[model samples]
Target chain A: MRSDVLVGAVSILFGMAYTVQTLHLPKAMVGNPWAPLFFPLALGVLLVAMGIVVLLKGLRHHPSSAKKGGSKRLIVVTILICLAYTALFERIGFIPSTILFLGGLLFAVNGAKAWIVNSLIAVTFSFGVWYVFEKIFYMNLP
Target chain B: MELIQNLLLGFSVVLTPLNLIWMVAGSILGTILGMLPGLGPTTGIALLLPLTFTMEPATALITMCAVYYGAMFGGSRSSILLNVPGDGAAVAACFDGYPMAQNGRAEAALAISAIASFIGGLIATVAFVIVAIPVARFALRFGPPEYFMLMIFALSATAAISKEALFKGFISLLVGLMISTVGIDYQTGVLRFTFGLMELQTGIDFVVVIIGVYGLGEVFKNLENIASGGGLQAIQKKFGRIWITLDDWRRSIIPILRETPVGFLVGVLPGAGATIAALMAYNNEKQLSKEPERFGTGTIEGLAAPEAANNACSVGALIPMMTLGVPGSGTTAVMLGALMILGLQPGPLLFQQHADVAWAVIASMFLGNVACAFINIPLAGLLVRVLAVPPKVLYPVIVALAFVGVYTINFSVVEFVLLILFGLVGYGMKKYKVPTAPLILAVVVGSSMEQNFRMALMLADGDFGVFFRNGICWTLFFLAIGSIAWPFLSSRIKLPWNRS
Candidate 1:
């Protein structure tokens, strides 16, 4: 359950998966046989070897304490909010989605202090930025 | 004589009204952004890249370089006033700067920092100009094999020098290079890692990764800190005086002079940047000081050396990028990306082909340093007020800006999603104490490395020994091996000396 071990295991899995994918690439007709696959395959093997070393070191060392409960929950909530905002970005429109996203983030961080002020800021920022980008810069904002 | 003429041409280009205004504007904006917690020059340049899309290449490049200079100056302000480093490079500044603020000499600290920054930047710019011309000429002889070896040296040096565990650094680099391998393989006309996704066919955009990793990732970390009640502290408003006395000047001058070249040389090396330069300069100053113990207690020399080193380093990083087409830091890599976006290639040919753009950029750096120092010194009091805006309010706006910046670049939904994904990954990397610089640098140079690697092999008819056949390539290969081995060797060698 050590962090290094987890990292090493993930790396090994990724390296193996990448090696398999590289093997499946169609061969080239000309140039070196090692052209496309050479660099990646070598990297994969190096990765696996390093992962094993890290895994061994991790097993030998003491595990560090895990992240705090509240921090973890907050990070999870933030990620979910960001995912929702991204999913609804075009559908809800830039202004509405951005306002909601900003307002939600503000509330999440500060717990609803000065609700009117937060709302004003959220609206102004979303609209102001949208205007600058769309109207001034001529970037199309969905 | 040629240098003088080129500089005159540069000055003429930069002296235009619009370009001058852009330079000043970039300085102001970059200073403010760099003063913000967790946002450095890289983020400042990345966030503002979309605005320059419509401008001329020379104008766009000048603006970005000005921002780069402004950010370096601004970084010292936060380190001096609040003891919070505005960026990684400013960490050394905090050692002596915070103590100065604590000792009620905040104004003196700020003044000396600005002055030292100006001197360092000026000297480094001069050095960059001197080094770049010959380096570019020398680089003209570089074939594919030499380029490949240079990139390998860069990668290895980056991995070895990063503060993280060496293996972890290499792993982070491998991750980046692997990401670069995604999309259609150009030579074979085959999709490598597309996995049937239309978006994957083009691979991931570097800007998207940058925005996600540095911008949004920083936000996520700040959010957790805020939730944990570990947010920004209220900054002290009373700055006594904006001037350093003659005695203060006397103490700072020598350290500033001594650290400039040290910082510049460090900056010239690819992958080792301002952070290392500042740390080394600070340490060297401490060693040479009569009062070594006074270093962490806010001595003027302690404050000056690192500030000078880091600011000088900002200019030092440009030399390799301009002359050899290799970025020396994350910020330089972003600037390199900016150059490519503006339809200009950096490298030896840049000076010959786009002399106007190159010279203007160089001239703008000179102008930017003067502008930033003047602006920073007079406005230090007002700028520190930016720290008053709590994380709760500021981070949300930053997140919105990041999204807007990324969206404006290509407006691809998949890229935006990739931004979020990398942001989380970047957060995880930070949590695990893995350095992100090498990873970012790898992504920037990975494609070029691959191209040069293949080209070298093709030219030599698949002979593996072609990489070491030439002296330049052989030297670079050894340098790469040496850099990677140096850390381990140093640790082992120290044992015997310690015993003795």
Candidate 2:
């Protein structure tokens, strides 16, 4: 599918769904009952209209020869690493989970061939950031 | 007389020891962040946000402003040396800047960029000083209807006035607006599209989106580039001399002066930013030059004009954000949001309510511009060593910092989840060839836009005609319509009346 067409279709679906959700918002006990719904409802309708225009425009154009979504797997791996980091953050603490997260990303993207260097960087960045935020700023981390 | 007193007041605020330290620190950090691809002023300020939480409002703003322009300066460094722009605002620099490096005049190109930027920024700051007070005073007269109209003009112009991607801009904007609607409604205390998550009830912070898109999103995108064998290139080590010659200086001075105003004008308009200003300066220089063909071939005029205009544009863009509280671009939106968090809200009353803070921000722009040039030039050789650090390791560190930045927000792991999610969203937007500016700008302006609109409605007793009750409203309405129409009209049809 053409990119614009796919995006447009997604937008239309999103807009319609959003409109329904806006409609279900609890009625306001104060001020106009319609006030909360007004802006969002307009946004939903406009998004659907914009989607149609984009879809129509995409239909008129010839298929593009743009570069394929290069390195899809790499992106997936990074996201998974991040997800694991998020899940582990509170349980494992900032220092340990961050090192694992950074180390994991480095290994995946930078390659394990330079394992020692990547490990060092991940460890150093994790510790350095912790020291600054916790010690200097008096801001806590999970 | 009043102007001089205000200038002194501004200087006094900036001269404080704490403010000076933060300003210098911000300039240094901002340059480093700006030099990296995918990070711009937005990411730079957002990443440093937690640091500013402990600072005085003036100090925090000063530091962020330093980062804002410092990144603009550093952005051109990569454009000249590596033939890649650090951000969107630096794209025009690549047109002639890269060719200059290729010609082994990298030193000259680097020097001229700093010089032009310094002169341009100083002049633009002067203009800002002259206009800021008047503009703020005038803005005091604006009511809810006027503000709502202004919001419409800014949003529609942002969506409509791009060189291309008009519809894509709209899509990006609507998505941002939708994101803005996610939290609980303020006036009526209605729960919004919170999806049962307590975090959603408070609303998704725009700072998280910035960190995700600019920091993590760029990293995600870079993984693709690295996989495709398009990682950052090796750096050049030596330069014969780092200063521009009198000959190069003579050619550049005129274009730099001419373009600063153009850039400043465009910067004041909502939705426009340094990228547009730089491009316009480049185009204007090309048209006026005797050797227009020399443009893409590394002409000094081409390089200097864009460099000057973009820096000037950064300074000029601050006017609207500071004076009227309507940010014209993503960078300013980030600044506005960060400042609001710092408890120094920018708007018509800012100068009246917090005159010291307002003027200090203006003064800091001049200092930041100068500080960035100092960093980018004398330390150009030292800084390029950073580029030698392989992207493989650098990207991961950036991701860690992004998480840390978000974590600083509420010190919650939940914010990290939101960061990653927005990062993915940012990556998706990139893949689909959509611009991120309108999306971010919308997110920052979204809540306030809705608030002003509702307030206007409430005061007018639900009569829609209240919007058109004033001249300012009509002016904004017309400007918005014109901006939306121009893209379609400019290409498709030319009437006979145009023949005259």
Candidate 3:
């Protein structure tokens, strides 16, 4: 029930913010000035309306706490690892950063016990793809 | 004659040694990927989009379509063997397929599934050749107002997936449209909501968003599932005899035929996809059965009906996206994006401008189906080896590939941030029970919908009444309203044959 309300409330807030942004969009000297803003504005308004319905539906449903599954810590750890990988992606270059990214994720997900297998997969994937894209396809990779 | 000529043209292109090699490779890879739990054809194509980045449109599409058919068959393989459906469309197979396997007739079950899918696919492909040209030509009459309203109808019908949470679908589509509204307004030079980022100029690529949402999002969701002790227990798969009995074919022939047309029609309708077609076909078979009680206790007819419908439904779903520019399901929506990425526009123009490409896709469907059947039938034992791969190890590879694909497209890390952002968003959307397919359709069609809408208004000189100026628009409006209302009314209305 709370998830619904939270989603609804955030939607309404975003919609309002979007509408405000739509209002400030520069008037086009070419065609009708209002034409460009029309679609976004309409979308913004519809979102608010839908959000209200969602909020009402949430309120109407018998409130039982939805027992959420999955570990937040694991998800967060994956995100942080990705962030670190992204930060180091250009600085450390493609192959090294990718190996680290894939390695960190594999280890985080699989475990320390399977480090050999995990490292092998990580190394093979990163180097194999990099070589293929850069050398064979002749496509540039950051 | 034209159909034959078109098929010959497509064959000439696809029969090349190079294209055949790609087709075989793609089919095999797609089967492996599809056997992986939680990765459907949508994810398969999205993950593989990078490899197609440099190929010719026909070659790229051939590879993708092979992947599509391979994944379709692979989805049901796991359903029969492990009772774990690899894709949503395979859920119906779980009803009787697992029970048949448990009864030690796993070989019969697998064989019949392939046979049914092949018959359904071939028939549906013939139907596609017959009808696709007419549908494309019909869509040529759609003016701006008609096209815009048609998009509205398509998106709305897609969102009406649930009776209880219609708003969730609305919110999902609105989120997609909102994302589409970013970057500079193509009509006016004004920036809508870039937030002063240079990379935001081109707006977000739907492929990146899709890879993030589907590819990464699925992995993230799987990660969550693994952590929660909800992952499927790995089973050592073994196949018995690889051929179905003559008696098995006799019982299934009727159900397969009955469901093919039903599946085809449902599949062509926007928002009703292969999953629903399979489910409906299963129910219809049960209703028509003389021994309905045998359904849950491992009946050959039960497995055959849904398998036939599942393949038919996928073939039927492609017609709209390839001809009318309205993607009927999420998988088609993803493939629609791929078609556009190939620098060809779908709809009436597709047939006129890139007729060879459009026909080639249909022609490839025939070969793709044959390829899938060949691999699935003889190579079933070899392919099921991929089932031993653990989800924990497999998901990281998907994430790495998705990000690499994203990098190849734009060469920007800003897209990576958006990928991660939408990945989380997609995960959240799934958790909340919001359908993400409508969101993909909305994103794919958002720009065109807006453009047509604005064009209609400009043509009408700001009069809103122009929407009512055409019969097609009126029909679209009526259907859109009906589509939304049907979900709510369906539960209340009692059908004569609704046993449930």
lDDT of 2 by residue, A38-116 (tens): 9999999999898888888887898778657677788899889988988999998989999899999989988999999
lDDT of 2 by residue, B1-500 (tens): 98888878998999988888888888888888888876777878877876787888988889888888888888888888888898887888998999999998999998998898888899999999999989999999899999999988888887776545788889889999999999899999998999899878889888898888777887888888889888778889887768898999999999999999998898888776788789889988888899888989988889999889998888888998999998888888888888877777789999989998988888788777778888878988777677677788888888888888888777777787889888988888888877788888899889999999999998999999999998989999999998888777866775321221
lDDT of 1 at B476: 92
- Which pairs of residues collide in candidate 3? none
Q: Give the Cα lDDT of each candidate.
A: 0.84, 0.86, 0.86
Clashing residue pairs for model 2:
B271-B328
Alpha-carbon lDDT of model 3: 0.86
Query: Scoring only the second chain, what is candidate 3's TM-score?
Result: 0.98
Ordering by lDDT? 3, 2, 1
Top candidate, metric DockQ? 2
For all the predictions, what are the DockQ values?
Answer: 0.60, 0.85, 0.80
Instruction: Residues B384-437, candidate 1: write the lDDT tens digits.
Output: 788788878888778878887888777776777888899998887777666677
Which model, 1 or 3, shows the larger lDDT? 3
Give lDDT: candidate 1, residue B224: 74
Off by over 4 Å in 2: B492-500
**What RMSD value applies to candidate 3?**
1.4
Predicted structure 2: clash tally: 1
- Judging by lDDT against the true structure, name the best candidate: 3
Alpha-carbon deviation at B19 in model 2, angstroms? 1.7
Candidate 2 Cα deviation (angstroms), residue B15? 1.1
